[model samples]
Target: MAELSDGVAIRTITFSLLSSPGLFFTFLTIHYIYRSYLFPYLQPSMSPAHIGVAIFALSFQITNGIAIGGWLGSYGPTTSSNWAKHDLSVYLGTAIWALGLGLNVWHDDILRSIRRRRGVVEKGSGEKVYEIPTGGLFEYVFFPHYFTEWVEWAGWWIVGGVACPPARIFLVNEIATMLPRALQGKRWYVSRFGEKKCEGKKAVVPGLI
Candidate 1:
């Protein structure tokens, strides 16, 4: 959004700066950079379906970014609206974002440490290991990473305030898409470890899903 950040209010500038790559730098970007080493079992070759999904996801993200950027630059709040009055929201959002990101990284590290200890694939057999995650929020939910991501974006929405449709849509869309995937992941865990082992853990939400 550097190209569009000429004369936006300080609030908008700060919001964009934090919510831009800062929202994902701790997880998504880092994860993708080392994805090959981390997930050696994944094929190097991309299928047509993979390409299609990538195109669609990229397009959607770019469109969403533009929408949010445009709103922050022109259509949304400015200093004229007495931004100081809304400081609470921005402060609260920043706290929530940090908390969410910390939890996400911690949970991810737990899984990675497990992989490091147990090894990703068994020798000779070439079978992948699937361990049930423990520690922190994993004791309550199957997909704490996904849940914390939703939390991160929920903070994004709060920082943008109630009037920002783009921020609301962004957070809502993330939940809508990730929720089903989290559910599927829970089912996969159940299939792998059996229903008995996964009895207490919910999909994404604790005691809910």
Candidate 2:
């Protein structure tokens, strides 16, 4: 079997490789919440519903992780020889992933910058202020970050190829969960900024919701 950069045998797209991007994304999210949102904007508290949803989502993700790990390690053993043939896919997928990651960070930073510009909490009164974000894909979609994330995982799917059911399911699940949230976010933007300002923008996709 061919050895990957991690010194793991590249039999199939293993859990570590498939999961690394997700872990990185999670890291960024958690850091953003703590470093920016949580301390500055939100007062921390726990609600029953919040705990329940967190547990629910966590369980589902854990299940997906186990399934994906199991499949690649045992159920589907892609040979090193097979891996060699897909070199082009590796490079292409990496490029796609990089592009998606770049856009996601850039757009998310735009939103963060907007919030930070006026300070997260107003000085004496302590009112949180918000403004419409601009830059990058924000011009076309209310949630450009969401769309870019889907693109990031699409690259993961492509790297795994057609036979990778685990990757396929993960990508599908991400869309299913995030799509509604994006739509709701669009409604919020419309309410905050007005229908006229939000007229041309879509929920997550640019020009096509």
Candidate 3:
């Protein structure tokens, strides 16, 4: 096997370490899409607008993966003794990302279970109405999955270093999109179940907004 630093520049190693989580998340998304077939109860018909949004989202993910990966791989590995220290942030970030991924998957499973248990089906216009999920992270936040996703990308940005332009941009985009979406979801949940059921839960954050 080739040595870890063989043919890889120090900067490349740093960049790769930072960028690896993005690629991992991209692959995880693909895996989720592939495995979606196993969960027929969770699938819903897509409207033209929904399809457009899906395509755009997928394209953006692909582009983000490419940009980060390409930038990292542009240089070769170097024979540097300081690689371990440089990789500290990467390792920490990966751990956080993994935690977030687990939470996201678990929350999704809970949502799916709720839908199946309630025999939820799509309406004539492809609308799905789900009961309030009060289990798992949903007990704390109205949109725990989205919150975990933000945590995952926050880890990504940390791994890439806060100064890295691409990572910063991605983090900004996530905040801009997810925050509003979570707020809207919170509103919808309150409207459905009234504020009593959602008494203690925040929109995305647990203790703070």
Identify the candidate with maximal lDDT: 1
Q: Best TM-score goes to which candidate?
A: 1
Error of 3 at 139 (Å): 1.2
lDDT of each: 0.69, 0.68, 0.65
lDDT of 2 by residue, 182-201 (tens): 99998998999899988888
| Candidate 3 lDDT trough over 10 residues, lowest sum | 74-83
Model 1 over residues 133-173: C-alpha lDDT tens digits? 89999999999988887787777677667677887898788
* Cα-lDDT of candidate 1: 0.69
From the highest lDDT down, the ranking of the candidates is: 1, 2, 3
The deviation in Å at residue 154 for candidate 3 is 1.9
| Model 1 TM-score (2 dp) | 0.75
Ten-residue region with minimum lDDT total, candidate 2: 39-48
Candidate 3 residue-wise lDDT, 1-209, digit = tens: 33232455334343232344444345345435634564344543322557777798899878876866554444221323333444676677767767876787788778767665544455444765668787887878888888887787777665554555666778789789889989998899899989898898899989886
Residue 103, candidate 1: Cα error in Å is: 0.7
Any idea what lDDT model 3 has? 0.65
